[model samples]
Target: MKYALKRIFMLVLTMVIVSFLTFLAFELISGDPAEAMLGTEATPERLAALREELGLNRPFLVRYASWLAGFVSGDLGVSLRYRQPVWDLIAPKLEITLCLCLASFVLITAVSIPLAIWSYRWTGTVFEAVRTAFNQLCMAVPPFFTGILMTYLFGIVLRLFVPGDFPDLHTRFGEAMVHLFFAAVCLGIPRTAMTVRMMRSTVISEMQKAYVRTAISRGNDRHAVLTRHVLKNSLTSAITFLGQTMAELIGGSVVVEQVFGIPGLGRLLVYSISTRDYPVVQTVVVILAFWVVLAGTLADLINQQVDPRLRLGGAA
Candidate 1:
């Protein structure tokens, strides 16, 4: 409980820093929100009024303090684009993004673990070369490129799935699943390649340890040696990578979401950024930062439980 509290406190501190940096970066940008909102035809009086309304006329520190206070109170401010509460704009989309990220994560983990196991089991030969080649190809490509290729081949050319919108999972479960199936595959490919490579390397290295040889010499089967010992010792880095991958999911899925026209947080983020919707952008960035911190905390806790050595490895 005490450790958890400490982790939570650190997360709060990190969020504060993230919020400050986000606000500062946006403020440093050249464009004025009022000008962006009202266009070139905006009069001086109209711009002044808009600034005052949005609290943009206030000093930077004052605006920051107010923004922080409101954020702590669950008020993320009003969106200039939608003229609605930014929190409301994001709330429904949040679940969609969470589902997508989670689905991608699941795909990555599922594919990576099995691939790693297989590669380790089938080391040294043409099959291993094939496995390595596949992983390398997947890892070499970017997510955006993958998304575009998938969309062109699947959506534009073949017309296999709808082009855009939050897929209707309730009624069109199979179709929705198929759409996300491709999206998850694209999102997971690079991540899975990286993860499988890391796990395979780690497992191979762990297998070289003295205890592994002792177990093998004792007539332990391959499965027992791999699962009971090698995997247990090798998964620490994998868990850490999984945590980092969770953080990357938000940003990496942007291209995938845009290609699919999915109403996930990534798409919303791109929209907000393009429109210079400060409240929405700020809220989303802060939320993403909180998620990253949360992922790291959870990973640390889980790793500590699974491997006692991790307790002394510092909170990452």
Candidate 2:
């Protein structure tokens, strides 16, 4: 209970710091938001009035405080570009990004674990060599590049789906999911490769430990010892690694969305940044930071539950 409370407190504090930094960074950026909105022909008087209306005329600390308060109270302000409430602009796009992330995560988990087990079970065979080479290839290629390849292969060559023709997520939910699945495959491949390597390494390490030898000496079959003991112990590290990968998937999704021309938060964020939409950009950045931090915290908590040493304040 104490640990969880401490973690929650830290989460809140971390979000506060992230939000402040996001706000400050945009404030320090070169362009004037007022000018960006109004364009070059606008008079100085118009710019001043626009700044006042957007509350950009206030002291930095005061504006930051107000923005933070609005964030906490579920009033995320209005987007200068869209002329809509920031949350309203974000909500649908958030769903699309969430769907993409979720699909990528599911793909990662589904593919990594089975392949890891297979490679571990067949340690020194031809299959293992091929699997190792495949892992290297996947890990070597970045997701964005993989996304481009997928677009060429599936979208163009095979005529599976047209590139940059994403369906309306609200109206064609099922078809939209099919399109996201392809993008998810691109986003997930490298992460799946990484997880496989980590899981395999962890399993190998666990197999070398003293308990494994003891169990084997006491007449437990090697396979029994592996399945009953080594695999379970190895999964603790895998769980933590997967959590970190989940956080990474958000960044990866941004690139994937661009390649696929999906109207997700990543696309919105890029547009917002280009247009100097401070409210939208700041909100999206802070949300991404929150997810990254929350993923780490959740991973740590799960590790504490899975490995007693973590709960006892010992090294993992």
Candidate 3:
């Protein structure tokens, strides 16, 4: 309970810092939201009035405080570009990005674990060598590159889906899922490869520990010992990596969304940044940072539960 509370506190602090830094960085950058919004019609009077209306003319700390307070109260401010409430702009996109990340995570976990175990079981065999090579290849290739290949292979060549023609996520939910699934595959390949390598290595390392030899000496079946003991111990590290992977998937999905022309938060973020829509950009960035921090916090808590040693160490 205490550890969880401490982590929760840290999570809040981290978010505060992230939000402040994001706000500060945007303030430092060269771009006038008012000018961007008014574009060719941005006269001196119009720019001044718009800045005043948007509270952009306020002191940095005051604007930051107002934005932060509004965010805490569920008011995400209005987008300068869209001229709509920021929440309204991002909510649907958030769902799409979440679905994409979730799909990629599911793919990574579903494929990596079995492949890792199989490769471990078949150590030194031809299958293991082939699997190793495949993992290496997957890891070497970036997600965006994989996304392009998948787009060409599945979208263009196979006619599985149209390239850069994403279905309306709201109206064509099923078809949208199918499109996201393919994009997820692109994001998952490299992460899955990484997880397999890590899991296999950890399992191998655990197998060489003293307890494994002791269990086998006591007439425990090697396979049974592996399933009951080694796998559990090996998963601690894998869980940690998966948490980090989850955060990476969020960031990586941006590129994948762009490659596939999906209207997810990542895509929105890119557009928002380009348009100097600070409300949308700030909100999106802070939300992404929150997810990243939350993922790590959850992983840390889970690790402590999985390994008592970590709990004790944390307490100390």
Candidate 4:
């Protein structure tokens, strides 16, 4: 509880920093947004008027403070491109992106855990070698490229699903997931590979520990020792590593969404950034940052629970 509370405070602090940095970076961006939004050929009076209207003429600190205040109130201002409530523009797409990322995370976890156990069980066999090689290949390939390949094979050739035709969640929940499955595959494969490798390494390392050796000397069954002792102990590092992958998953979702033609947050972020839609971009960045930090905190809690030493105020 103490650790969780500490993490919660830190999350708030981290979010403030992220929000400030995001706002500042856009403030520093070259080119006058007001002038750019208006025609270059427009008169100076109109440009100045536009700048005042958009609050571009405000001091940097003042504008940032105001934005932060609005953020705290759950008002992210308006999208420059769409001229709509930033939240309204973001909410639906954020849901889609969250769904995609969540499905991918679940799939990766489901696949990697068993595969890791299998690899550990057959450590010296040809199966281990094959699994390692295949995972390495998957890890080497970028998600965007994999997404394209998946689209070609499944959507173009196999016709199992259309490349970018995601159905609305409300209208057809089942059909939407079906289309999302392919994109999730692209997002999950590399993560699955990474997790499997992390699990394998951690398991091997745990088996070499003094406690493990002591258990073996006591005539404990090797398989039972692995299951009852080592597996949970080894999973701490793997969980930490898996939590780190959320950043990559968010990034990959952007390119994968584009490749697969899903209108998720990633695609929205890219479009908003290209259009100099600062509110939209800032909102997305902060949301993603929050998600990553929250995931890290959850992973830490899980790790602590798995290893009592860690739970004891992280003595180890």
lDDT of each: 0.85, 0.89, 0.90, 0.85
Order of models, best lDDT first: 3, 2, 4, 1
User: What is the C-alpha lDDT profile of model 2 across 77-158, one tens digit per residue?
Assistant: 9998989999999989999998999899989988898788888988988898888998999999988898898889988998
lDDT, candidate 1, residue 141? 96
Clashing pairs in 2: none
> Which regions in candidate 3 have their CA more than 4 angstroms from the true location?
313-316
Clashes of each: 0, 0, 0, 0
TM-score of each: 0.89, 0.93, 0.94, 0.93
Report the candidate with higher TM-score, 3 versus 4.
Answer: 3
lDDT by residue for model 1 (148-207), tens: 888889988998886785566667667877777778888889999999999999998998
Where does candidate 2 stray beyond 4 Å? Answer: 156-160, 313-316
* Candidate 4 structure quality by residue, lDDT tens digits, 81-160: 88899999999999899889989988998889888888888888888788878988999998889888888998899987
Where model 1 places Cα greater than 4 Å from the true spot, the runs are 152-160, 168-175, 312-316
What TM-score would you give candidate 1 relative to the actual structure?
A: 0.89
Task: For candidate 3, write residues 97-149 as lDDT tens digits.
Answer: 99999999989999998888888998988898888888899999998998888
Candidate 2 lDDT (Cα, whole model)? 0.89
